[model samples]
Target: MTEIYYVEDDGDIGEAVKEYFESRTFKVTLYRTAEAAKESLRKQLPDLVLLDWNLPDEEGSLLCQWIRSRWKELPLMFLTVRNDTKDIVKGFQNGADDYVEKPFELEVLYSRICALLRRAGNPSGQKVISCGTLTINKEKMMVFCDGQEVSVSRLEYQLLLILMEHKGITVTRQSLLELIWDQNGNFVNDNTLTVAMRRLRQKLNQPSCIKTIRSFGYRMEDEI
Candidate 1:
């Protein structure tokens, strides 16, 4: 059965949702604290994560960002009482696949869960991608270069995948931020992108792998 890590602090709501998911044949694991959820995650990642907006220890959005940094393809959804547009945008910026306000109908929630799981199972639907002499499995979230496995932070991998998807074309900073950063069209500082690119180049360790465009954006350097 497909597994989901459901992170919510409220006992009543969590139990109700867990039962709802169970009735639909989904294997559900409940987590009440961010630390506990994160600790369990280190052992093995879940197929999808259902996060709440408010946690006893940390905000749900923060946990979502943490998860995105570690595994980009892992499906994430925010099921919380936070109904504001800002909260919704924050969830997206932090790598959430979808957001549903609390007090949602059980049927609607179930439908959303099914849709997310279905999408996760489809590899062809991925928005960002990467490929090279090195093996970069976007779906599996793994990277291999120079006959050795390379460890990549989630953000770096996300950025590399985005650039690789466009390959020869230039991708702008605004585009990268909108796509990669959990920010919703919010201006991202240059340092964040710079650091991610520098790390990506280091992980690939290819001097001319990524070329910076002067006025517009960046592109992968031509390979012979």
Candidate 2:
């Protein structure tokens, strides 16, 4: 199932959106405060996050920044009353993938959500991805090297999936940070990528599976 973490302070609005999304077969977890939402994010990364501009404890923008710093690939959208052009721009700057004005049509919201998921390459549930000797089962969130099951962190799995999706192409460091880390490459230290790559390679037991394109980025070979 597609999981959504929705943060809204208003009880009526939160309940209504949660109920509607649940009806559409989405697993919705609603939070009335930014702190609670942040806590949930740390436990498990959701497919998408629907955030309100104003939370009872903190501004949604702050929460967005925190999330981006951690789960960079997670899709986030703003569903709030802040329709001002400045506010929209700020939302995007803060890390929102989409912004919707208040009193939105449920159909429109659903469409936007689907579009975002599609763009993120998670259009549906239970996807199996394979590259070289590695296989990833999305629903199970598990990885296998050859026929042996391998344990990997959530970030490692996300990084591997991105590389596998674009196998053979040198994914630039900046691109990796934007797509995998949700941070500007300039702001994040390159060592972060290095450590993650090292761990992933070790877990897969195939160091040659991922190649560093010296001064550029990394590439996943078609065969290990």
Which candidate leads in lDDT? 2
Error of 2 at 21 (Å): 1.2
Backbone collisions counted per model: 2, 2
Q: Flag regions of model 1 displaced more than 4 Å.
A: 122-224
TM-score of each: 0.57, 0.58
Clashing pairs in 1: 93-182, 94-182
